[model samples]
Target: MSLPPRAHQLHVLACHACGMVLEDALDSTGHGRCPRCTAVLHRRRPNSIARAWALLIAGLLFYIPANVLPVMFTSRLGSGSDNTILQGVIEFWHGGSYGVALVIFIASVVVPCSKFVILGLLLITVQRRSAWARRERARLYRLVELVGYWSMLDVLVVAIVAALVKFQSLSDIEPRSGILFFGMVVILTMLSAMQFDPRLIWDSEDT
Candidate 1:
């Protein structure tokens, strides 16, 4: 009996111990354990570059307007004001909601931007097959994945304020252009993360 020529290609593997699927291709040694569960793993998928590219591009596109447009509108006692994402953060900070402001700053502004930059770096590095700081790159990818959803905090806040502060003539809250852009940013980053193939980092090292 002979194995197929493609059988040696790196592919996603499943762990027999914890039942967790490894995102990267199996080690050439024909035996590798799951990073999460330390269980023996098997090949599952061969490549993930195309999906990752699409996601990163989408995220890059949405990153633009997330910062440019106004995220919320507030009307108080017949006086209305619209604030961009940064302005809202500043308002919260000036109004003594420092903690809330900080959270929003990190989640809405910093995290999304950072995620994009980091993912972009990783993609570029993988494409160039650069092996420097392999561990650091992997760590950065995990961080991006973890913080990706946090960017939606702004959207959540908008929804909450819109629902709770509906005083009509007295006070009213409305979604702004930034909200849409910000939402797209969140969605795009998530898509990027989903599209990204973490296994590539390790594969580059072997090559």
Candidate 2:
């Protein structure tokens, strides 16, 4: 059977230098490069908008629990303690780790939520064919892409604490619901970043 029109068009734009056609580029690790110029020919991911929406929605759903539940449980000297993201931030602030706390709050909470909201707004604007500040919208999309990975900071912290604080009975750190939810939020945002297409913004400008 013949491929769809869009797929056929993508294939026609294959990089002559790399001999990579767009049809085979949708895999997670797959990329198409120009054989001659070594330039990227085309991104193979399909249904980028739909994938982004799915990820964004999932992230939004998980963000609630990531903030509400305890992210870490600390057991030291037979005394146990649990901290949510906000509680941890407050502790860090009061303990004079203000900078660290700020970084954690922004990366673990603010950035992800901001990306989701910004991307959703951009998508909605584009879908509505709103011609307002196309350039600005593109810039926002780039920002979202840049900040998407930082959401993993919380997960990294949890993993590191889990690894380093392995005192077994005397003192130990355990991952909590918030950590898992935070991880999901990060993954979902990353997926959203990957799925979003900046070209759509430009396409709106042309229309």
TM-score of each: 0.78, 0.79
Q: Any idea what lDDT model 1 has?
A: 0.78
Location of the lowest summed lDDT over 10 successive residues in candidate 1? 3-12
lDDT of 2 by residue, 1-207 (tens): 963454344545555346555454435435656656777656434576788888889989998998999999999999999989889889999999989999998997789879878989977886787888988888888888887898788888988998899898899999998889989988888888877877667654434
lDDT of 1 at 44: 33
Best by TM-score: 2
**Model 1 lDDT tens row, 33-128:** 678877666543334556767776777777677778788899999999988989988988999999999998998878987987898899889888
| Candidate 2, position 122, lDDT | 78
Candidate 1 has a TM-score of 0.78
Q: C-alpha displacement of 62 in model 1, angstroms?
A: 1.9
